[model samples]
Target: MIRGIRGATTVTSNEEEEILEVTEELVNEIIAQNSFLPDEVAQVLITVTEDLSATFPAKALRRFEDWTYVPVMCATEIPVPGSLEKCIRILLTVNTTAAQNEINHIYMREAIKLRPDLSSTKRLAQ
Candidate 1:
């Protein structure tokens, strides 16, 4: 069976390091929370809010993890009149036997405001 885990995070700045740090953190958390093995991940699709374009968030995620074999693609998120800024979102599809309810979705920073329900359900690291 295949399952998808969703995550979103906001960057404090558009700088390369800041983008890289936050993207890596969110991706790592999503993978850990679901106990997803690298080999089981089918692909990762990422989108960054229109205000962010300094660097591709996927590049940071790939470089930060031992997921050289995993496929990742990134694009600009659709711009809305009053949407959140400097945000990056991810949809990770992985091959797993876990049930839908077992999957963990993450929302952080300003992006947390986009989905308070999911954010409130998160189990953050101690």
Candidate 2:
């Protein structure tokens, strides 16, 4: 079955290095929490806030992982009023047998400020 794993993270700056570091951490954490296998990931869709245009988050993820064959794409998040800034979010479509509740969703860093409840539950360090 196809399952979706969702995650969001925030960065302090739109610099290339900052984008790369935060994106790497976010993607790595999602994969770890969900126990996602490279071959099982159908596709990964990433979105960065409008302020974050220094680099594509998906590109950072690809460089961090060995999944050269996995399909990944990145886009700018819709600029909604009151939306978080310097944020990067991901929706991973994976072929998994796990139920929705069994899948882990991660929100980290200043991204944690966006979801205080979820932050406590997330295991950081990727």
Candidate 3:
């Protein structure tokens, strides 16, 4: 079965470095929490808020040499009034046997507000 795993994170600035660093951290946490291997990921859809134009969040995956084989696309998020700024969101469609309820969705930084109830209470690494 194919399951969608969701993860979101916020960058401190519009700089490319900050965006890449935070995005990579977010993806790492998602895969770690879900026990997903790169080969199991069929597609990755990444989006950033309107204020973040310095870089695409997908670029962060380049840090992982094995992740190059996974398909990744980036887009701009729909701007809504009072929405979080500098946020990057990812929806990963993976081929896995895990039940939907077993999938762990990660929300970090200010983006945690997007899914407070689903977000884990585990302390995040600095």
Number of the predicted model whose lDDT against the real structure is largest: 3
* 10 residues in a row with least lDDT, candidate 2: 117-126
In model 2, the Cα lDDT at residue 123 comes to 49
Candidate 2 accuracy as TM-score: 0.88
Which residue pairs in candidate 3 have backbone atoms (N, alpha carbon, C) closer than 3 angstroms, thus clashing? Answer: none
Model 1 per-residue lDDT tens digits across residues 77-122: 8898899989999999999999998777899888888888787245
lDDT of 2: 0.82
In terms of lDDT, which candidate is stronger, 1 or 2? 1
TM-score rank order: 3, 1, 2
- How does each model score on lDDT? 0.85, 0.82, 0.88
- TM-scores of all candidate predictions against the true structure: 0.92, 0.88, 0.93
lDDT of 3 by residue, 1-126 (tens): 999999888988899999999999988888888887899999999999999999878888988869988999999999999899899999999988999888888999898899987675442431
**Which ranges of candidate 1 are over 4 A from the true structure?**
120-126
How many pairs of residues in model 2 come into backbone collision?
0
TM-score-better candidate, 1 vs 3: 3
Candidate closest to the true structure, highest TM-score: 3
